[model samples]
Target chain A: MNRVKSKYLKGKEKFAIGIDLGGTNIKIALVSKAGAIRNYLKIPTNTQQGKEATITRIKQGIYQIISQSNLETRSISGIGIGAPGPLDFQKGIIHFAPNLPGWEEVPLAEIIKEEFKIAVKVENDANVAAWGEKTFGIAQGVDELVCLTLGTGIGGGLIIGGKIYHGKNNVAGEAGHIVVNKDGPLCNCGNFGCLEAYSSASGIKNRVSRRIKELKISDPSIFYQNNFDQISLVKIFEQAREGNPIVKDIVEEAIEYLGIGITTLVNLLNPEMVVLVGGITNEGDKLLNPVKDIVFHRAMRYHVADLKIVFGKLGEYAGVAGAAALLWDFD
Target chain B: MNRVKSKYLKGKEKFAIGIDLGGTNIKIALVSKAGAIRNYLKIPTNTQQGKEATITRIKQGIYQIISQSNLETRSISGIGIGAPGPLDFQKGIIHFAPNLPGWEEVPLAEIIKEEFKIAVKVENDANVAAWGEKTFGIAQGVDELVCLTLGTGIGGGLIIGGKIYHGKNNVAGEAGHIVVNKDGPLCNCGNFGCLEAYSSASGIKNRVSRRIKELKISDPSIFYQNNFDQISLVKIFEQAREGNPIVKDIVEEAIEYLGIGITTLVNLLNPEMVVLVGGITNEGDKLLNPVKDIVFHRAMRYHVADLKIVFGKLGEYAGVAGAAALLWDFD
Candidate 1:
């Protein structure tokens, strides 16, 4: 038999290259079919070096991972990338992400495929994370799943009937934009009263900054610093745990709005599991318990009966893992 | 070949029996494969007379339609039922419905199949309506569809990836209960500020009545009557069109909230079309225009780019047509 016939005939060529392209860092990994990270590497993106340099760096990273792991290039099942988007997955184009400045319709997949002489796939960052969780993390074996990446801004990913549901135009799963309060506050998406405005990290900090001014609590050293811009989520949570009044209400409201937003998702999608990922998940049970209580209490009775709301097990590796999984069949 | 061998050997055996179970009436029809209603039957439910009577009436109606249409029992595809839910579409059991009193775990499909000796399917009413629209009505050929039944209550049916999405347990499409204004008004589902409270027929009437009491508009004959309970939606819309204060704000708010609720759905589900159905559709452009305006301007740009927001074309026959379509494989 020819080498091409051994693609899966021998059934041991079970590795894939996964790449997570972030504004600050690029994470690349050599992952096995069973989801083990055989080799991993992280490098600074240094986006200021421009798109070409970033592309060159990614190619170098891919080579480094393969060589360090001592794996043959043919034994690998190509490369998969997860990046910030409004990008086209089918075309593998980056259609100008907010964080990835100057990236306008760059076909990253084609570039990588040309270098590697193998398959290459690219997906939205949030979707990649959700896929990672569904494939090998907390949501393993769960068909209907929702993954929320709560970082600087909230992002949502949906898995329906065990398949990634990239709406009609690949623009579905805008869960963070669900309007929880129709007239509450402005969101980054230019809408008012979005769930993101109330629950996201940026929104929480902005709320605190605005509330500090509105309430005229200038001496905010109890929780925040003299500089409103210096207010970190960690300090805010610490103060809330200590019952510092300035931070308590804001933290509690964030939790409440997050709960309400999640309840809306639970009611709408009726997913088997909701996996929480990103910075906000670090708060752990403090953030998760109340959100669960509200969803269980507020969502339709049948939806909550067997539903699970938990943190994603993959953590930072989700982007890399899920991106790599793009080349693998879901089974 | 025996008679059974002709199931699909001859495509001419294309008739299906459809039964729409409602609080006021049971609509039964003999529908052909080409979306034509060969014979239609309507009967008053007289729900006060109880379940057995209703089921018998349904059976009698089915027999009448088949006889009237001159369709042979063997030629008919099967029987399909559309009923108020949370019903088990798979097991064909109705857990209970708010309108269908005392219908506890009724094995509707099993009961029908036992008598008829053919395939029988029971589905949630909203799902049936959505399926009907997808199969033979306004949403024909539209893959991602959202159908709204706007009557005493607002109901939602979803067609995701071209099939009716029943969520995890078939209790998925409760569009009416979407909490638009988290603090708006009390809904029948024991929730506050649900879209149903702001947009449903009963909710609209209730809002006007409460506003009359709150604002002390005792002389409501300019639109509503002295008997606050008789404040009909038709009168309310007419007065609102004429710019009457008592009815104008309430009507405008209803449309606005409905728009906002739908905008939320568009953002989340990214449906290609949203078909509005039921009594409120009588207002036509007056209702469709403002709702469309809000959704178009407020939802994510890509979601609205090619989205079609139109009135359901099936009219009163939607329930019957949709229920009947359950026995046919969706193209």
Candidate 2:
């Protein structure tokens, strides 16, 4: 009786509170029955205060959001959370999240349920974003999709057959760890040639640095006009946009690696859509077009024939929305 | 209703006929409620006679299985078939089977249902094998598994969350087409560096042929004791078992490629178990041990922490058993 059953929802409308637990901050939102955010609040996570104090802060944030919005507590049916992963999603326990120290086997959902007196569900952050995409964003109406969150580290979400696919250990859809090249580069995950090691923000930065160093070594005068120490993804993209050949080549190389990784997913999963979510989306066609070219030309014809490679529609709110989207399973 | 409802089978002792339709032959079996084969028979496919003739042969095979077993026709409640892909399993239609020429969008399940007056299900051969493995093979009790069939070509089956994972276009689980090496050999599927191109039977043959040619050019005296013109996978394994250094190197090289491919699967899927099927299994420990070594050493540690790599238990009859295992979905 703890879990909501589908048969109970004959005609009733229900709303849920969504919590996005990140390393720096926590974002809480009152998601309506129609998946619209009626109220939102942001607060620093302050994990240094320890687990009990952090839980207290989250509960306070929830109460504040409800009081500020003047909404009745009875109106909220459940609570959903999206948190850093490698956790036991089914058990709603944080099984040693790297970003959240001292959060080993933390019974998050159980505690939240106790505090709110409502059903609570917890999922991986990347998977929550994917659920948000499938329910309200670009992947709407798509039964199968692979969403990649390109940032300092790449995160993946696999929506297969209209549901988040949690494999044996709730570790499925680890596309970032997929090896693009057998002997390319070493990853922090202690693997060689992983997709994240080549296509992530840091990966791109490293590539650009290598290219700049090579160019500087060959012709020091070429880089004297620009601030070489200001090396970053934004700077590299800006330089590439201005037709800097070295920066452009670096961008192209990273795109090729991303395309290879995506192509691998296309061949293995054959998803209907592949949505890219992150700061990289700002480059638009410069990143998407070439990645699409390599994926289409490299993957099996039938798989890529109708596959849509697009940017995520939810943007920054994807995590919050996707966290709320978790209730869709019960609703 | 064309499909049987689970509720309708509350008290019925239902049985099913399982058929594995391959390019050269058809395997038919009467499967009981316990995933056991009661009666079995095999017949040549003779696909050249056209689709209608092939259907007739399949129908005849079914009748033979029933009549020979002296079983009541009413006892068999349904029929299931495992056919080559990439077919529309949901619709029971063959999109285009390269092996079974002339089969294009063929309504196989409906045709068989009409003839037998029973519910029928059709699935991809690799998927059927995966289901069979889940039901009665090494993957029993495992919720997530990846089954790889290595023969003339490589075929894959993805069992995620204890169910067959059919992505958007029913073309998922094409693990054979995964790019292991970006600039390796070309595959018949019109892609370069595919797992199939390096780990398949023909791929091994090509590698052995190249190794033989290289050895011959360097020193013909080593090959004077054996025939160099005849080269095959069977020959390579046989020679390697006798401590032939050249053949041992080729076998090891192929195993290295297989390891990389399996490592990729491990990192992406994080399956609880990986069941490898085909002639390669005949090599047994020679192949399994080395592949396990590389996968454990190369893949992410947490992903491969408790991974199980084993051979399919059903052997050549896996296709037929898998075909029968399709009924477990309904049961």
Candidate 3:
């Protein structure tokens, strides 16, 4: 199987590489025009070691993925790296990524392209992931779509007419930062009442923790006692499934805020499909049903009639697949 | 001069006829591919006579324009009409136009096309005006743009990748209805604190009137006494220009809210250009400067840098010009 895959990759003329630089790990993959993962490699980001080392490690991971494939370096078309931002995509530099420590305006794309002799495109990780979803996941056939990644901080991407709408300065699709509640909690973006403040994983966790602390509830302190050791969304989903009111309440609030955020996008963009991706979306219809219901009720009737809200299907491979899809466009 | 203009218009095979159906008047024009208005005519809408009479008046206007033009109906590619909504663009019907009394689902386009034996396309006035801006006005050459028409109600249009993004249904660009303040004011759309309630022409007039009534100030009841006299935005601009404290306060507050609304679009669409058209934008730099300052300060910095906000240069002719531009494409 490995030999067949390797042989198939060897014949490609415009292969591309996708590197998903996350906080904890660097995931590199060799992508083909067919949206196939020719080869892939993963390594620790070691963000604590600072920016230089992190870039070096990412470079090495790229090399490892390339070395595993029989493809020639000359035939490689481009390299797409998806990293956490504030980023200057036009300059191919990272501005300041909280996940990647000591990373400050690192011209990672330029360095990689220079060393590897391939074209490089850098985008916000969420944007790239959305590209992946649009190209290979549930958003495959849709032209106008908005993908929301509900993780630590909510990330969004706008895909219009089958291509990414990066806005004026590659900063479009900051849907999470849109104000949902003007008087709600303060968001990390230094704004009051952003959707991210209420709907993201950390947002929900914060809400749950605050409620727990305020009520002085005596239940499983599994999350607090060990610094949320086992209090993940998965466990919370289970609690909600088993009819725990506290867990249900927290989820409900998150979904409510999320609905408002979605409604705002619906009114603004009028996208045909809104794909919800990320770890939290794993709650499936439990989260999606309420969100759809609220958004429909809140949105104008004309805007809601044809709107579709669905969970992403690509799962963990979206980043790499999106990166690979970038190569397909060149072909 | 008429002969010379007729000769120029005759040379074009791809000419479109655009009709801007207004409350009091109907403006008709012949548009060239280069976004030029070859010729135009204005006729009374005569809405008090009812829908059939209004449609007849529109047909007469179309006939007059076509008959006077040297260009043949065969050479005229298509007819595009921009009118008040709610509309069913697909069916080429007007749903409910507040300006046109007893107007509901009037198949204005279909009837016109059948009468003239020409193809007709109909869109909401705001959407067509937005198209005009995108195709020929301040947003010319920009593929992705958003236009805000500050009239009785705030009407907006989104051109995504050069095509109008009409949302899931045909109600995209309802930016006016988007709630900005939860506790602000009651909007006619049954929402509280919508951007329209604070920033539109009527909204501004309403605010000013309410303030006067509340304070029992002895200003002329121009707003209340003469309903049909038309509370001109020019009057307010003049007052603001002269430093009338109350007028200044109202304009500034409206500017602030307008900034908030624009910032929301900047964060959401991130289009290459945002064109502000309508009477309110006539405040020009007074409104533009404050809006730019607030949007830049509040929006994600990356999104702000490349955004260009400019006033519409086409003036009152934009609706007809845009409708004409549609002919450029369809022709």
Top candidate (DockQ): 1
How does candidate 1 score on lDDT?
0.86
Model 3 C-alpha lDDT per residue in residues B1-331, reported as the tens digit of each score = 0223456555644678999998878999987777778779988888889888888888887777777777677767888999887687888888787788899878888899899898898988888888888777777778778888898888888887678877556777888876676556788766567788889998988888777768788754443435545555667767777887767778777888788778778877787888888878767787899898877877676677788888888898899988777666531
lDDT of every predicted structure (CA atoms): 0.86, 0.81, 0.78
lDDT of 1 by residue, B69-132 (tens): 6556778889999999688999999998788787889999999898788889999888889988
* The TM-score obtained by chain A of candidate 2 when compared with the true chain A: 0.86
Please tell me the interface RMSD, in Å, for model 2. Answer: 1.1
DockQ of all models, two decimals each: 0.66, 0.62, 0.46
Which CAPRI category fits model 1? Answer: medium
CAPRI quality of model 2: medium
Q: After superposition, how far is residue B169 of candidate 3 from its true place, in Å?
A: 4.0
Best-first order by lDDT: 1, 2, 3
- The whole-model C-alpha lDDT of candidate 3 against the native structure comes to 0.78
Candidate 2 per-residue lDDT over residues A20-110, each given as its tens digit: 9987789999886667887788899988888778888889988887665555555566788998868788889988666677888899999
Candidate 3 local lDDT, A108-225, one digit each (tens)? 7789888988788888888888899888788877877899988889989888767787766667788888776656777777666778888888777777777777878887654443
DockQ: the better of candidates 1 and 2? 1
Candidate 1's displacement at residue A93, Å, is 1.8
> Which of candidates 2 and 3 reaches a greater lDDT?
2
Show what share of the native A-B interface contacts model 1 retains. 0.57
